[model samples]
Target: MKFYNRETELEALSKMRDLSFKEHSQMTVLTGRRRIGKTSLILESCKGTDTVYLFVNRGNEAALCKSFAETIVREFDIFVPEETSFARLFTFLMELGERKKYNLIIDEFQEFFYINKVVYSQIQDIWDRYRKKTNVNLIISGSVYTLMNRIFKEYKEPLYGRADSLMKLSPFSTNVIKDILKDYKSDYSNDDLLALYTFTGGVPKYIELFMNQGATDIETMVDFMIRSESPFLSEGNILLIQEFGRKYGNYFSILTAIANGKNTIPEIEEALGDTSVTGHLKRLEEDYELIKKKRPIFAKEGTQTVRYEISDMFLRFWFRYFIKYNDLIESQNLPLLADIIKKDYPTYSGLTLEMYFRQKMMESHEFRNIGSWWEGKKSTEQNEIDIVGIYADDKRALVGEVKRQRKNFKPELFNAKVEAIRKKALFKYEIETKCLTLDDM
Candidate 1:
């Protein structure tokens, strides 16, 4: 469960801190989904430095400020009024920055929207007044994507355009996951790697949970997820209710439909028994970023051949199993639910293996564009390519057929599909075909 990767992010943060020390003041905004290790990264970066870490929770502003003042006093050995307001405490910090340099970290900063929404304006005023004369490296982290975007990216918001650097953290890569597995179970199999990728998708928190429980393989990980008190049972709902709000039922239906293999608009509408989901789909893709609209490689933007996919791997798995069988979970039939997952995991993990190789190719930085290619009017007749990666100059491409087991990959059929795509002449380049399986990871 030790920290892995993030060398680039740590180096960027170090540069930001050095800049704050040279120039009077600088503000950095860190954003990511819940449990992506934002707090860990920030704390690791600020180690061995004078830092005042304030965790913003939902409460009365005066009460929260009292707790923050206590932290400042304990950390810096300076006494401020316990009853002071946040605006006053922040102004005091800015004043202190005039005499010394330090890092100020505010975790879950978007909670201020619930406690006192005016706090953003108060900090804005204080920051503008003292930024030029203070030597404070201010860092704020938020998990609420919509609220953070509004607070920092929307021009009308008080704190808009105030940040000198913005960092969006992503999940660990395939190699990092391998490194983590090697650290714990050096003699791991390809199935272990695929199960980890299928379940955790490189999210550090979930991986750490599985590793802590000694769930190093597929069956144990599935059991750990579907047990009576497992956090995985409710994690997707907990992470998304705030984002989707009251109309979450419709969003959930759409997502579940996609996860269940109804990716096209018409198919989803038919599955939902409702046709008025265009706005919801747009919001899911553009606003919430939970789903994405994908087209075939080399397809036009206006092409009607589009598919919707859940952007998070874990959410896809959750909706596919837990949400799809909520009745089993609600009735306390966790063992039955785990059985269902075990029965269906092979088919489900086949698709996830395709995604794993696509991610691996992307992380290699060897492709200009990467996506799937399909051509047919009907689902039964569609000739689909698992992966297509075009080089920078467009003269070379990697067309891959991915399968869970190498034995399942039929070379003749794969070559026929590649030939069909070549007939289209989508890219007048040399296409290299390969079969990617779990062993490639």
Candidate 2:
């Protein structure tokens, strides 16, 4: 695939490449979910440069040693003994870097924990010994969240503060989807793009799969994406398993419960099994990077009215449609799913639009900060503000709700919601109010 926009990251990589020749080793740690094109980004940036890519696996120490030796010998055409260990192989690369400038990439780096628990310390030793004498740019990439952070970000880790650059590769933006549609000569309308964005959230791999058939209508998309035997059908299960292992079953239950409209802690626990969900929720938020705890809009720091929501657009969509109807989908009844989708889609999608707004708020420069708002009452008296953006410099804030159906924008609904927001806003910063929509903004 010809690479799309990563101009900022590319520039950052180039700067790191230039800096690699300085006294210290120039290292970058790239982290993201699986198949968000982290490797693609690395490949594109390393083009025409002397670069070596090594993919680490979760095998035993001896197997990993052999793989490293083979990778070094095969990629560099260097003669080496069969029984060489990774320590020796990496040490040799460090010496080579003393003579020539090169880029070294270790993909799926988190597997090193399983392969050799001491590998990070060993690398740190080599780096400290030879960093000033070498001109190598090292990039460590991983899909596992906790392991990667422990190796590089944790204060006590051997490689702590070692990275000169850290890039967390995220899903592509909605604009990228529009660009893809335009490039493919698909004349999809704005609403179609919004629906696609709601479902895929700019994940390049998922978008490309659904875009293959040259149809962009939401109804057609639901048919193609949720149908039996579709590659995307059970993708959520695979994705979560890859990230969280067997514990993914619990996480899946939590996400599915949220998708079914269970938001509070007690509600989620009841829906999943019991209060044991507390541990699973913590891991989902802290380790897997899949969910977030949401407090009411204007709540103070440490305010207690909190709810949980899935943080990824594609996962939310998957749980809402595919996982919720797992039985029907598995029994080869896609038309039945299509029917359920037809009935529930508007409601489900209206929820997704709120997420869409969050993505836009993250990327937009118009707002200084953005978040959601709700009342202090956890279950009872809960009024929601879908999108809340603050413009402190302007003494103004933008409060808006997102709906899938096309209808006239109403100010009365805004007034009712604003009162609830005002009650919560008292504890935090304040600003004037404005309403917005997809077109209005």
Candidate 3:
């Protein structure tokens, strides 16, 4: 459960902090989804330095500022008015920056939108007025992806273009996951690795929870996740409700359909019994960033062979099992729900295995483009290639067939599929065929 694989991010933050000390004030914005370890990374970077960490909780602004002032007094041994507003506290901190250097970290910076929506404008004014003379390293972290994007990226927002640096933290990579497993269970099997990837998707919080409960294998992980009073049961809903709000019904339906294997627009519409989901789909992809629109590697942007997929592995699993079996969960049938997941986990993990290899190939940095290739529609299952990676040099490509069991991968049929796609390929390049199974992990 120890921190793993944030060396690059930590180095970047260190450079920014050093720059803040050498130059004037600098603003760094850290953004990621909930439980991706933003706060941990920030605290680790600010260790051994003078830091004032302010956690934004939903409450009256004046009361919140009073608590913040107490923290400043305890940490920095300086005093200001206890009843000062957030605006005044921020201004006072900036004035202090003019005299000395310190790191000012505001966790959950987006919560200010709920406490007092105008706080952004006020901070913007204070930052612009004092930036040239202050020597503070301002670090802000937000878990609400959509709100953080709007606050910094939108041109019309008050804090737009104010950040000197923006860092978006992603989940731990495949190698880091392997290291974690090796530390926890040195004799782990491929199934253990796949189950960890399938469930946690390298999210630090979830992995820590499983490791703390000694759930080192597939069955134990499923039991721990589905037991009564398990936090995993309600995690997805809690993560998305704030972003989707009152209109979550349609979004949930669309996501569940995709998770259940209806990826195309027509199939999803048919499954939902609705025709107008274009706007919702766009928002899900572009605004919320929960889903991604994927096309074949060489396909044009206007190609009709587009598919929608949940970008987060954890959410995909949650929608597939937890949301789909809500009735069983609500009826206090945790045993039944766990049994159902255990029954279908093989097939589910098979699909996730394909995703795992694709991600691994992406992290290798050997390919310029990576995606699945299908000759015909979804009905023609034989014409699909599990993975296709165009080499970064542009002269060679990798076509792979992925399966859960090594016995299920037929080299003859897979080679024939590769040849058929090669003939239809745009360029006359060399194709290397590969058979991937859990052994590759």
Q: Against the true structure, candidate 3 has what lDDT?
A: 0.92
- Tens digit of lDDT per residue, candidate 3, span 1-441? 677889999999999899888898999999999989999999999999999999999889988998999999999898777664798899999999989899999999999999999999999999999998988999999998999999999999999999999999999899998899889999999999999999999999999999999999999999999888899999998899998989999999999999999999999999998667889999999999999987877889988889999999999999998999999999999999999999999999989999999999999999998998886556375688889998999999999988988898888788778877888873577888888999998
lDDT of 1 by residue, 60-161 (tens): 888899899889999999877666478888998999999989999999999999988999999999999999998999999999998999999999999999
Q: TM-score of each candidate? A: 0.98, 0.89, 0.98
Instruction: Candidate 1: give the clashing pairs.
Output: none
* Cα-based lDDT for every prediction: 0.90, 0.77, 0.92
Candidate 2 residue lDDT tens string, 57-146: 777667776877777777778775665467777888888898878899999998878777787898999988988889999988998777
Residue 281 Cα positional deviation in candidate 3, in Å, after optimal superposition: 0.6
lDDT of 1: 0.90
Report the error of model 1 at residue 1, Å.
2.3
Q: Candidate 2 has which clashing residue pairs, if any?
A: 297-373, 297-374
